[model samples]
Target: MSYFKEDFKYDLTSSIVVFLVALPLCLGIALASEAPLISGLISGIIGGIIIGFFSKSSLSVSGPAAGLVVIVLDNVEALGGYEPFLVAVSLAGLLQLILGFAKAGIIGLYFPTSVIRGMLAAIGLILILKQIPHLVGFDSDAFGEMEFFQADGNNTFSAIIASLENFNNGSFVIGIICLGLLVLWESKYIKGVKALKQIPGSVLAVAIGLILNQIFISSGSALAIGKEHLVSIPILSGEGGLTAALKFPDFSAFSNYQTYVTTITLAIVASLETLLSIEAVDKLDPHKRHTPKNAELKAQGIGNFVSGLIGGLPITAVIVRSSANLDSGAKTKMSAIMHGIWLLLAVAFFPTFMNQIPLASLAAILIVVGWKLTKPSIYKKLLAVGQQQFIPFVVTILAILFTDLLIGIIIGLVVGIFYILRANYKVPYNYSTGEFKTDDGREAIKIELSEHVSFLNKARLQTTLDGLPNGCHVMIDGSRSKEIEFDAMEVIEEFRINAPERDIVVSVKDLPGGKGRMA
Candidate 1:
């Protein structure tokens, strides 16, 4: 009871914040995908309500991901229509389910900590860059794109240049005011005040944006944010609007090869994004809780399945929403679920009101969110950790800034692996040498194996063994080692066999092989 009360108390404030944050993003991603406006809402609803209800995660929020917008747009065109794409989404959900049952979710665990941190930082930086245009009502670039290269062929830097000419002064004014409000709302003193803690600053930003928009209209002010700069969710009119909006998948295309191809593509992309976001969210969670990866996959499958049924685009655990939820003081999955409920109510009875919101306001909110994700303090802390980690972390940020998310992560992982192998190869074992003569007064060398010496140390060990002098006692000690690679052990044995040729005495103590283990 106490836990429930504590969690619920946080949920109310956070759920509204997440809802406000997610609303425009959902619509923007759909606009980028060229999907129906309602499709994004459907996916957001399923991701928040259904996935959150079924998932064991305490903080992750699922939704229509911007990462999938490109693939969705392409597949929707290739498959000839939106209805067939829904079928692909359903099949993708089944694929996710099978993958979860196959235990493929453990793949996320293999990513290095440095690479994950780099991913978070890179995403933060991307959010700041990509949302800047929207902050000023420049809509030339694809909405919700986080990659360096855009769907319209402009890279991140070029897009910013374009935004300069495309800026709307009205949006610029609203965004600046909202940004200031959000920043003040997040200040230490304001957060420390108990009364302000009950109401989220993002919710207030939305209200302010709406009121200011109305004031601009009623006063006949030329500075008013127009329809293009505001959210434009189609207002539903009674039961007919709901019926027309719900798109069902057509199974007639089941035998089409493109259908299967689209399914496989969506499944792989969505699952990977879901896993990556889940890992990222776990890192951001204040309580240090871990979301079960396999369970998360299963929940995503269910969310996508339901989303597809309702004519929505594919669903994934979206990092933007998850991060927003975490930053807003979410303590349980209920925050996510309630956010979905808020989406449902807004879409059902209040879309016209929602449409009054300025995109600049939401952009300001995300700008603040992005700033929090990659604060200079985080950068300084990573740099303090040392070159081995900081190199990979920074490499990831640069790669992601210059490329896409998955590609950037892969690049960072490769660099991280290279550093790990280099570090391991440099010092796989510890050694101390003494001129302890044998009974014949010949000097000997003693080498001690370090714990968990892997295959990477193979060549180094062989080189040292080859340098042994004739008529000398050589001792290789593995007594202190808990794990030595079989290959290393074999190298020891080979040197032992070859020692006779050099008139050298070779002795390996507690080496894992032969009758012991490694042989």
Candidate 2:
């Protein structure tokens, strides 16, 4: 009620927008997953309403994720049936439940900020590229999968080329018209209209596309849009009869070794995707509210369990839908919930209306969404952060574009680790030249150790100590140090014991007690 009182209007309006954005994506991701289209819609409904209710996040939208398409497809092929795969998804949900209780979501903390940004940017670029073919009326390929290679036997770039070779003039015309209308809808004038603001631009663009498609067909033009170019959603036979769509997992398959392997793989990948999307969504939140990681994992786990029981793909928090919700001015989780309601209704009652919509019109809307992700400001900011951050960010983008998401993330992490170690490998001790009077009026130089000294600092320390003037008194202090690696301590002790050879009187301060060493 509080949400209704405070943000119901905004949430409801944004829900329709998200529902529009999510509809085609759900179908496209399902196509890429090689799963039944109904499975994708079921996951979307469960993800939004079920998971959104349980999650504390204000803006994270969950669904059948593009990141899992390859994994799901491969698993399906290996498992030999969709039912067995459903069992794996259910087991994965249980695994996520255990992980949530165990606080395994803490692993999200280790992903570097640069890598996360890189991931989002790469997805954005992929969105733009993947939609190009669709925008040209090339309906053979799927949209929103975000993989380097597509299900239509084409890679990202090759699809664009093929679309050039095979494209419909009507779809191209519709795409431009829809894109123009979308641009205008975001303008100040259109936004000024209260009623117009309530109706999302995507919905309008789709309506126009439907009309244009009808006109083209009626005119008997060569450029008329065909059935293949339009959306196709299976209509329900009747109301509240979900029994036909519901699919139960074959629990008997649990004994198979491959089942556990697929289950574990799904859990791990789904968890990573969820954590990453949550991180990205937080960045997009206007209120700057933080989501509880473990709670989100548990919510997703519960949703996947239900979705799996009813014949759905594994669910994860999805960044693209979350971003669209944020930009559309959603204020609460209710928007995500309502979007699910809309999806269910569309499938059950309004599928005929949905089927008339053109894919090119949807592509035009996502093109705008994709542009939002790879804004010039983002790249400029990353560049200003320096090479350590920018390199991993760019490397991640290239890796994801060339390989798969998981492999890309792994490569980005490796690069981030390299930067982390490079930063830490420098000397730890502070070198401040201070002259002190010894008992006999000799000048002594003192060096204080930092909290922890690793062997990586050995070279600099050796250089400084070796360059010290002969016959000078030197004090090597470690009183404040919590740890000193053996190799580093060796350098200090060697300097201490070899003092006479260099005609230098060396004294050790707070040297750690140990078994016999040269004193």
User: For each candidate, what is the lDDT?
Assistant: 0.85, 0.85
For model 1, residues 1-519, the per-residue Cα lDDT tens digits are 986767887888889989988888888888889988889889999999999998999998999988788799899999899999999999899889989888899999988888898988888888889888988889776557776877777888888788888798888888889999999988898989999866888888888888887888899988788898888777778899888877889887797899999999999989988888899899888788988899888898888888887899899988788888888888889999999999999998888888888988888888888888899998899889998899999999999889878888889999999988889887877766673556766676888788878789988888888877778787777888899878887888888887888888766778766323211
Error of 1 at 491 (Å): 1.8
Question: Model 1, residue 55: what's the lDDT?
Answer: 95
Q: If scored against the real structure, what TM-score would every candidate get?
A: 0.95, 0.89
Question: By summed lDDT, which 10 consecutive residues of candidate 1 come out lowest?
Answer: 510-519
lDDT per residue (tens digit) for residues 117-207 in model 2: 9988887887788888899998777666787876667788988898999988999999989999999998999989988887878778888
Candidate 1 regions with alpha-carbon error over 4 angstroms: 1-4, 435-437, 469-471, 514-519
Off by over 4 Å in 2: 188-199, 218-223, 238-246, 434-519
The number of residue pairs in model 1 that clash at the backbone is: 4
* Per-candidate alpha-carbon RMSD to the true structure: 2.3, 3.5
Q: Highest TM-score among the candidates is held by which one?
A: 1
Worst window of 10 by summed lDDT in candidate 2: 510-519
